[model samples]
Target: MYTLHYDSPLGGILLAADEAGLTGLWFEGEKYFANILGPEQQERETPALQRTKRWLDVYFSGREPDFTPPLHPVGSPFRRAVWELLLQIPYGQTTTYGALAQQLAAKQGKTRMSAQAVGGAVGHNEISIIIPCHRVVGTSGSLTGYAGGIEKKVRLLQLEHVDMSRFFVPTKGTAI
Candidate 1:
């Protein structure tokens, strides 16, 4: 595995990639920072890492990246499915966990799916911004459960031009 360090406007970010693509991106000191990396990781800038840096550059400049870098997030099949859905969230839009659960249920051909379960998968997303996990919110528009911290989540949404009036930081909740 190869890694690169980037100085983002919000904070320092550590990016990880391998032959396939970017495997992880985490804010310094954020929950689950580098959690997906194996012991054999090295600090070297690969093509994937460089491309990711460019993507971040566009993003931090307060504009949506016109392109997405290759991402190879590691997780279970269910988690991967959830991450795929996260990627579909529009650049400046937000969706609720319950809504995600309903979407997953329809995709899986089930009558119902648990919002808590969807939240669990969203919480464990290792790819962060590129996968757009920060776009997920609680049913009431509560900005909660971001492994990168709620403040960062809020900043990212603002960077994407999401209207902050619709979302609120929960005083008490998971990952608060």
Candidate 2:
């Protein structure tokens, strides 16, 4: 595995990639930072990492990136499915965990799905901004469950031009 450190307007970011593709991107000091990296990992830049840096560069510039780098996030099948759904969320838009559960249920031919289950899957997302876990919100449009912290999530949403009026930071919840 190869890794690179990126300094973003929000804070430091760690980027990781394997032979297959870009694997993980996490904010420094965020929950589960570098949790997937093994001791054998090296601080070296690869093509995948460079591409990711370029993506981040465009993203932090307050504009949507025109391209997406190769991503290879590692997780369970269920988590992978949830992450896949996350990628479909548009740059400046937001969706709720309940909505994602409903989408997943329909995809799997089920009548119902638990929003909390979907929240768990979202929380464990190995890749952060690129996968867009920050775009997921509570049923009432509450900002919550971001491993990178609620402040960062708010900044990301604002960067994407999401209307802040429709969302509020929960005072007592998993977000805290």
Candidate 3:
């Protein structure tokens, strides 16, 4: 496995990858700091990592990046489904957890899916900005449950010009 460190407007970010693709991207000192890889790691700028850094550069500059770095976020089937939905969220748009659950329920042909379960998968997303997990909000348009920290989440939303006036830091459910 390989790792690369990127300094962004938000803070330092860690990127990880292997032969398959970009495996993980986590904020420094985040809730799940580099949880995707084992103990062994070598810090070097590989091709994939370079491409991801470029992508971040464009994204942080307040321009919609036209490309997405190759990602291989490791998770269960349910989590993978949730993450896939996250990618569909446009750069300047947000989606509610309950809405995602409804979509998943329809996809799976079930009566209903749990929003809490979707939140769990979103929280466990190893690839942060690239997978756009921060784009997920609560049913009431409250910014909730970002594993990278809500402050960072708010900054990301603001960076994307996501109309933060409609979203607020919730009084409950991991909004810090």
**Each model's Cα RMSD:** 0.8, 0.7, 1.1
Give the candidate number with the greatest TM-score. 2
User: How well is each residue in 1-176 modelled by candidate 2, as lDDT tens digits?
Assistant: 99999999999999999988889999998888889999998999999999999999999999999899999999999999999999999999999999999999999999999999999999999889999999999888789999999999999999999998989898886755
Stretches of candidate 3 exceeding 4 Å from the true structure = 172-175
Q: lDDT, candidate 2, residue 87?
A: 98
The top-ranked prediction according to lDDT is 2
Q: What lDDT does the true structure give each of the candidates?
A: 0.92, 0.94, 0.90
TM-score of each: 0.97, 0.98, 0.96
State the weakest 10-residue window (summed lDDT) of model 1: 167-176
Q: Candidate 1: which pairs clash?
A: none
- Using lDDT as the measure, what is the rank order of every candidate, best first? 2, 1, 3
Check candidate 3 and list the clashing pairs. none
Q: What overall lDDT, based on C-alpha atoms, would model 1 receive against the true structure?
A: 0.92
Off by over 4 Å in 1: none
RMSD of 1: 0.8
